[model samples]
Target: MGRKNAGIKTVCENRKARHDYFIHETYEAGIALQGTEVKSLRAGRANLKDSYASIQNGEIFVENLHISPYDQGNIFNHDPLRRRKLLMHKAEIVKLFAKTREKGFTLVPLKIYFKQGRAKMEIALASGKHNYDKRQDLHEKAAKREIERALKDRQRY
Candidate 1:
């Protein structure tokens, strides 16, 4: 299941992350955004799909994340898909790097939102899901939905 992001202004989300991977843990990290990039994100022009975090030289960076160029920025607009740095603690980065080194573990961005007027991203430590596992998840969700509908109908009588 996806993380619950209540009481926050969500800019964009990777809706398929939960379906494609089994999330183990999540972290809230500040994004290092350029002036135009921040404006673009505030205007709701961002995509988290296919974005992933990688630790390089003991620092974390998010790759493939697209924040569209601000409409009025023109010549000063930042690159839409530049590698953005993520602000996280030293010890946490080391821990995450070690975990990602393990087989089948990776970092996936779940969502991006503004918290107390600052841009924050929710990144997850996840493992990929096999075809059979995906099928099972679908079936379980269907069953839960049917049960809820049946109970609602019963109460209406």
Candidate 2:
């Protein structure tokens, strides 16, 4: 049997978020999008790279999320790089705000997807990874790949 999220469809992912940060927690957030923005997202014209979330005045907003303008929107097309609000509970916002105030802790969007026709974003509470830490992770990944290859070869022979 295969595990499938029947109604969820991924739109975009920030692949570098994992390599650059140590993720501590993840939150599913609803994006407050305009009509053109939602249409653009449905067309798969969104980018999560270089985007991060910030808490301001008791509200959470995402910056640098680029959702291209809808082709047919013409006069009413929304700005591609405008900050978008994230919908989450007030208690959760307070928690995230506190955590982000700590040294090196930040909110990074991991991926954006649609669930049952509504756009959603998966954001993470993360801390930055140092150069050495990144190098160590790469080395470990290489080692695991080599070990897997050796095991497969052994079984084949």
Candidate 3:
């Protein structure tokens, strides 16, 4: 099947990232992973909830990401929480760095998925959301649910 339609064996997800941050932009970047790490990720044992990205020297790297070791791998197995490098074009990296340097902007990984047999990360440039904003979002969601229910009931009559 196509990459978009491929069966999702999700490696990790950052659920709270969207609730706590207002995402401004998103970019897809390839991840540098060892063979064992890739195997472990394919088994859906990765964690992205506590992960974040950082720039050092001139390269970008993902930190705090946990990729559980393959239970069957030998001494060559990879570390679960090792800092992995993200591969993006020079221009893209520069743009990301500039935007994330702003007061509240941060580099957050939203999800990890495999495409064309390669691992990829969906990263977002986001700003922290205030308590009031979160409350307002919840209220809007409730309102939308009410409207949808009313429409469905009317259609059934």
Candidate 4:
């Protein structure tokens, strides 16, 4: 049998968001896409590196998410960097709205993937990581890597 999530296709991921922000809460929301955008995504031509989510007029939207136009589309092609709406429950939206209004909290798009044949976005409630925090994390990771390597070498010996 195949994996449970075998049908999912990851179009893009914002790796920098994880490095720059401390994620607090995460949500999976459906994305609104046009015909050409969907076609482009099926071809794996999307970029979410600099994308983020925002609340406006009691609704949530994703900004700066680039979806390349379909090759066969000309006039029917949608804008590559359009702001798309995210579909979420009212309670979730309200919570996200409240959390983002606080100091240093933000809504970032971590990844975009097709789930169950529908496009979905992974949104994270996060706070910006300071320079010192990032440095400490790097140091910790390096130390862990060194220890793991040492253990492997000792086992081999």
RMSD to the hidden true structure, all candidates:
3.5, 1.4, 1.9, 1.3
1-113 per-residue lDDT for model 1 (tens digits) = 55464557999999899999999999999999999988988899999989999999999999999999999998999989999999999999999999999999999999999
TM-score of each: 0.95, 0.96, 0.92, 0.95
> Which regions of candidate 4 fall more than 4 Å away from where they truly are?
1-4
lDDT of 2 by residue, 33-150 (tens): 9988988999999999899999999999999999999999999999999999999999999999999999999999999999999999999999999999999999999999999999
Against the true structure, candidate 1 reaches a TM-score of 0.95
Model 4 pairs whose backbones collide: none
Model 2 misplaced stretches (Cα beyond 4 Å): 1-4
Error of 2 at 38 (Å): 0.9
Evaluate model 4: give its lDDT: 0.93
Q: List clashing residue pairs in candidate 1.
A: none
Best by lDDT: 2
Q: Write the per-residue lDDT of candidate 4 for residues 1-157, one digit (tens) a residue.
A: 7897788888888898988999998999999899899999989999887788999988999999999999999899999998999999999999999989999999999998999899999999999999999999899999999999999999998
Instruction: Report every candidate's CA lDDT.
Output: 0.95, 0.96, 0.90, 0.93
User: What value of lDDT does candidate 3 attain over all alpha carbons?
Assistant: 0.90
Which candidate do you rate higher for TM-score, 2 or 4? 2
Clashes of 4: 0
- The alpha-carbon lDDT assigned to residue 40 of candidate 3 equals 89
Off by over 4 Å in 1: 1-7
Worst 10 residues of 2 by lDDT: 1-10
